[model samples]
Target: MADYSQSPLELLLANQQKGYVGIHVEQGVPVLDRDLNLLQDLISATVRAVISRYVGNGAAAGANGFAVQALPTGQNGQDFLIAAGDAGGPGSALVGGVEVVIPAAVTYRSQPGLPALTAPTAAQPDPRTDTVYLDVSLAEVDGTVDAELNNSRDVGVQTSVRLKPVWVVRVSEGDAVPAPPSGHSFYPLASLLRPRGVATLEAAMIGDLRQRRLTVSDMERRMSLMERTLLLPAFTAPAPGQPQFVPKSGVIGQPITLNGSNFAVAPVTVRFGDLPAKIVGGASSTQVVARVPGGLTPGGVSAAVRITVSNLGGAVISDDTFTADPAPAFAEPTTQFSPGNGTPGTQVTLNGFNFNAAGTQVRFAAVAATVVGVPTATRMVVQVPAGLVPAGSTNADVKITVTNPAGSIVSDDPFRAELNIPAPTFATTPPQFFPKSGVAGQQPIILNGNNFNFAPVTVKFETFTAVIIGTPSATQISVRVPAGMTPPGTTKDLKLSVTTAGGTATSTDIFTING
Candidate 1:
């Protein structure tokens, strides 16, 4: 037995004769048995068989040699040889030499944990023809677990099977032929014996060898428990109903209509945007309509209705946009002719924006105005029906309301309808101007009229004998005769007039001289 663990050993096996190579071994033989004198020879024989199967037997027929060696290492230890010199055929060696060289380079390049080759040794004789036998033991196949075994042997019987199953075909004595099986099955050999009767009896079985991991029931249980909590149902209370009203665009004094929907019960609130849509009726959810109140912008406005769904819950539904038109498009009544301050029935035209149609009723300061031009949708021309604004220095406001189909109160303030209060009207009570009728510088002639207030009253003198009153009151005015007017010839008839806020009133000629 060779002490393989202590030092390295190189073995050479050659096919000097034609014979089949086979594995021959016994129980308890150490794979690296250095004490066993013939261990190196056994491993060399195994390697030669493998190489001859791959390459042809006669391929190394010259001075070349092929063999195996055992180095002081593990399964990854270097162990290899090749035929060279006259022992191997020409160009048969991996490099140039008759002696086979298992170079050190080959050993270093081998993968870890896998066997490798080493440097070549001196030339050696062939061992195959001489029957180079080696020893073996059960330990030769160490690290190979029972699980890796394809079949089980009889319990504790110590069965003998080839540690490495292999064989090589032969030719003649002193030389071996290389004929290896294409695959690792014994059936192919049986078929090769009978050429035409060859049949493929071997079949490979496949299965799910992997572990049976997770089951379906486990996943289902996890999914069912997710969000296991129960939830209660939700509810809401009902609310009362209200009326709805919408204003017409660009029309004055037109009432708005109120309609309600989804007000399940009665009390509903109707709002014109922010302002409350006044409900005239007391009934809930009933049609309670009101006029579009005065004072609204001219442009488009919207009405909103919000229903009280519940006491705790505020408005569930509400209309946010609606038109609120209050004033007429046309201007207020304008005074055409100035009537005396005391008199009524003054003529004036009411002018403004949408006053196109005819017969459109115009109200002047609460009094309905008389129509003139057809009040179109745009402009309304009308006369200020008999009315009077109170007397004052400031302009009197004439409220002229128009009536048409296009909703009412389009604008709160349309424009200024000015009605100037005429100054008081005056008339002479007695038609007479006595100029020089009174004694010169002695008696003063008196004039009478009506409507006389705070303004200065003046009398005029015509020539040296004639005299006239410049400003006179309707019932009372005393004008002193000028001393220059002789009563005799200046007793001529003259017209007298009274000046008042209403106007000047004249009387027929009344003569008075210093007779």
Candidate 2:
């Protein structure tokens, strides 16, 4: 016969006194105290109130599973017990008038490996453990368990018993489970349990356990420690005293120093916009020297320029602080005219660095010359302007200037312009013929002139032509009169003429031809 003299709480306390079972406490007092009726009423009212909010529907509420055992206090105040049914299986009962499903067996393990359940059998020749694999599958929200567990009545019950799934291992008797031939030793049933999902659940439970004992300050301290250990590279705005590139602005190809923190020893790349700057010397954690890339434009007036540093971790870009100034310099002229001399209408090519084709201006002395075509950054073609230097101007040392938006530069060497001489002309005083006149078929007569070109010369007498016999000098030429040059009259007046590459010249004095 059942003894109804003592209540369930009294029985539990008596059992605990006998060392048969344990008793839970709250604030140093047994949870199930002499006021058993009040404790029951509190539990019943809390459960009923929680379910009333979800009544009318078949939805389950209150604790996940409930039992009448004296659970340890602060083990998770929300965790309830599970009751046994009449058939010794999971019971379908209304605790505090709230329906609940008490699983047949509820267990949990917090360690890495599961325990041995069964002794070795002859047929199996391996250890086997009976396990009730609970899939406890829940839809994840926001990739975290917080949303799924938030305001949900499914609270985890703290239990010392390990609840790992059944693992069937084939091993010899009295020997430990042999190491797996390859891969991992634990081979689980895919359909029964998802290893990845289980791992995620385990991680979440560990976080929850940690959170239970941690205060707000403790959590903050732990977060700070994690941030320190991460060692993520950071780039801050350059300050006054910090190590940074000198001369924030410079021309392309100019060397600049970079001072900062957290730079790698090797494999570091510095960039100006998309163009890579040439690194100079070695780089340490806090300093680097690099030359500005030539890819930058002469006048960076349109867009901002950003400098970037890239290493093993990642890349960091600086604010648009650096500038690229134009640096137009003279390399050399294309034509190898010595002393940099050229005549009018002569095409002169100037080659130098940072020459803007469209914006560059080439000057001979103070006069701007005609640019042949669109000049390149390094080369330019221009024609010397007419009368740039006077015919006999001794001041031939004129400056050859090149100007652009960035700046202007003059040639280090001087350019010379020479004087131009006139063509040949004849003198009028000298008698054109040695004799008074030359008869037809007579000896040759000598003609005189000035400014004659150094080429073959031809002489003529009136309408009759003369034949040149010897080489002609700049002042004299010898020629024979034609046979029919004389007229029927006794004498005739005829003029003599001389022709050369320079030009044709006629003697002012006439000669008399005899019949």
Candidate 3:
């Protein structure tokens, strides 16, 4: 059995030698930076946090270079991973704390001895495919930069390549496909249009590589980080002066450690720049842990923004600045959708490059649509939302938007989809009554209406819920009058109504009821 009382992050970090860290200062023990790093790492690994996405979806036009483009070999003399000209600026994404950087696009493979893409031969020209994917892995580095910064040659640099991402491709026939090492980010960009066609078609697999398929060890590690994010730490009372975050720099959603005196208050609010940071457990007068907020790049060497901690004790800003890099996540690729018009339940096809089904969402205006079946990086299908327009109104222009961890993007133009939703109504006033005189529960009442079968139907008598007799048709439905009505009791002027999922319609004529 485990103790449910202790904070999840605290319990995981606890050990025999170190005392509980409600407040590091109060324990008279020195605070360990390693503890902070461990807590932060676990928080970071819970999800594929995108600090910034360097490459824009092909649909997002203008300005930024590195945005995905069509690379057709039929138009080029030599094989290349992307278009030949203007390899757009550096493309970077902050995944958790690791910077998945893409510096200067890898344009041509013509540099003799460099990798080459294989073309489909006349003997076997079945359209071989070659795909371009972003692979991320942990890389080790020596202390060259560290020595330069410290003016000494003795310093250490464990993972220098961690920040410097490599651009790799395949020779289609000669070289093996480049695979991203497990435990990091791997995103698909586009497939080369081989003479040939693209080789080794890959899914738009985004997020943590280790978690593509979870195992026991993977679950344990991920659970720790997820717990920290899900659990919010309660505020300390007595109110501490403005609290400052330790390690002045961090990426968005990364756990940050705060230290201050008199951090005693019931409800506390902390902000990184202008964005609000979430409060996790381990809060005390001397220290509190918080997740970093988005917006604002590093203005100076490290400081990016001012942090303000507000509580009942009053608000105060930290003297020390907290550095946070504000990079936009990848632009979602939602370019065009076909058969523009559709009704509820109609499956509409969408075209784009690279989509993560787990992280992707589709919406028609403000209403979300169901993303059904399997979706490829380049295409997907979604059902038109029933609420595309107000009930009874025919059609509307719904702008389809796609969102993922990187960011959100809308179609270039509005998609005109139909919502031919006609409300249920009687064809005639005081519509035809079946078997005018029969026992209340014995004889059924047949209500004639339009669109009765368009949706599920139900009937109501006054304040009672009536039961339906059988299946409803496009123009009619048979329902039993409320059995509770006393026989021939002369129940006068009862309002009879027909109801569907959309709304209810009361009849202009009233029913004077008798069994």
Candidate 4:
């Protein structure tokens, strides 16, 4: 339960207003718990309603004792200041009938807001407004009970409940207090405001936690719990040999290994919520294998189910609860993909049945591909990630793996990646270069073709490097023979071109060198 409603507290008070010295004990645990609660509430309500007003140093000087302080300029921080104060207020206050007391002064230092303080922003320049309140809660304390095994001690370390007092500050974004938020309470002792991206805070902008009186009944209406629910564990922990399921969570009709007492002696029955589950063969006294019942409705939030175990001797309800998942679908292999071969960034669509509705991933070979959006049951689109295949290579075939939480589907046929980079070609006069012939170092030769994606296209004559002139366009280029080319060996033909990230493109047309 997130919080207790007031009916339980009111019942306790009404019993005492009558003539009972103490509450009656009927149901062992619950009755004793009720008596403790009644006394606790009486003390809480008395503190909140009667002694709630400040007691010590009623003068404004002492009234501001617990007033929190910080730099006038805004800054991110957890530390704040409390002056050597002279006064104190009620030690406890009742919140929704639960009494909270404070052992120290109510300040943001010792007891910061439950959710902690939030930074300010430009759009909202107001500092975080907060009110300080005394809170007293019960904490379980443990002490070793080892004195003498027979005389003073009964067990190992034993646990006892004790009241803990601390300061609690309720936070509000607005200047005025609306209502207190349960579980998620926060506050700022000093207002931290951000306007135009620069934080600006001033002393007058801060909320007067004390020394300034504010109306309480005005905002006394009960408030709901915050986004996060504050939990007080039944103050218990799970022990071994308790009923447990192997797989604690899964889709409907999934198998669960349930282990408990006395299952082999007689036919045992297991139920998830109201649906009966099938108990597999080979049952043991302490173990029973079963499957989560099918047909339970799992909606947007999923379904919560309780497992009930029954046998010839008696029926026992499981302390652990199982969450029922919605229908499950295993993705199926896709044989057909569109435009299977191309450069990276080409989007491929896979056609298949029963593709996972969400969290579906597509991988081409070892490299993972990008999924376009949420995949439907029959269709999925993905973009090939960069560098699937090297340029100038033959078409590469890569297996496609589509998967989700349910399962994976790998295609027998592979997706093909053929990089768009092609080998260089040349503009030919009949069958040779445009110029046909040139001197080793002085003549200009023009070679033009396609796939000239690289810069500084180098032209060669035999074993010598030619000097390229200006820039080389994708389809045209002009070059001169190497500077040292002499009348001897420089007068022979050789291949000319350039290599780049797109691959080496060598011109097919050979240039004739002249002496």
Candidate 3: what lDDT?
0.54
- Stretches of model 3 off by over 4 angstroms after superposition: 1-252, 258-279, 283-288, 294-303, 306-323, 327-422, 429-431, 453-458, 461-465, 482-495, 507-515
Most accurate candidate by TM-score: 2
Which candidate has the highest lDDT of all?
3
lDDT of 4 by residue, 212-246 (tens): 22224322211322211221111112366443766
In order of appearance, the predictions have TM-scores of 0.26, 0.31, 0.29, 0.26
lDDT, candidate 3, 1-515, per-residue tens = 11223443344345312633232223666655445444543454332332323322221222222233434535434444432223455555333235444455555453346565455676654544444554454443334534343335455323222123443332334222455444444544444444444342222311111112122343454557655433333222323553356666765456887766445454777877777878988457767678875334322113367777765445667767776543221222344777678788888887754443346788889889888787665567888888777664457787888775545666776778775666877767445445444346654777776777755567877777778877888777788877676546455457677886556777666555675
The digit string of per-residue lDDT tens for model 1 on 1-515 reads 21234432222123213342333456786553433423444454556545434432222222222222222333322222211234233222211111122222222223245323222222322211211111111223322444323244435432322233322211121222223232211100000111122121111110111111112443453355443211111112223333233332323334455444333233444443334444455523323344333334433232223322211112443332344333345433332222312123344444453344333456656766566545444444455444334443233444446664443332244323434323433233333534424556644566544544424333444434324344444455665555655445555544445444444555565444453
Which of 1 and 3 is ahead in lDDT? 3
Ranking by lDDT: 3, 4, 2, 1
Regarding TM-score, does 1 or 2 come out ahead?
A: 2
lDDT of each: 0.35, 0.52, 0.54, 0.53
TM-score: model 4 vs. ground truth: 0.26
Scored against the true structure, residue 52 in model 1 reaches a CA lDDT of: 36
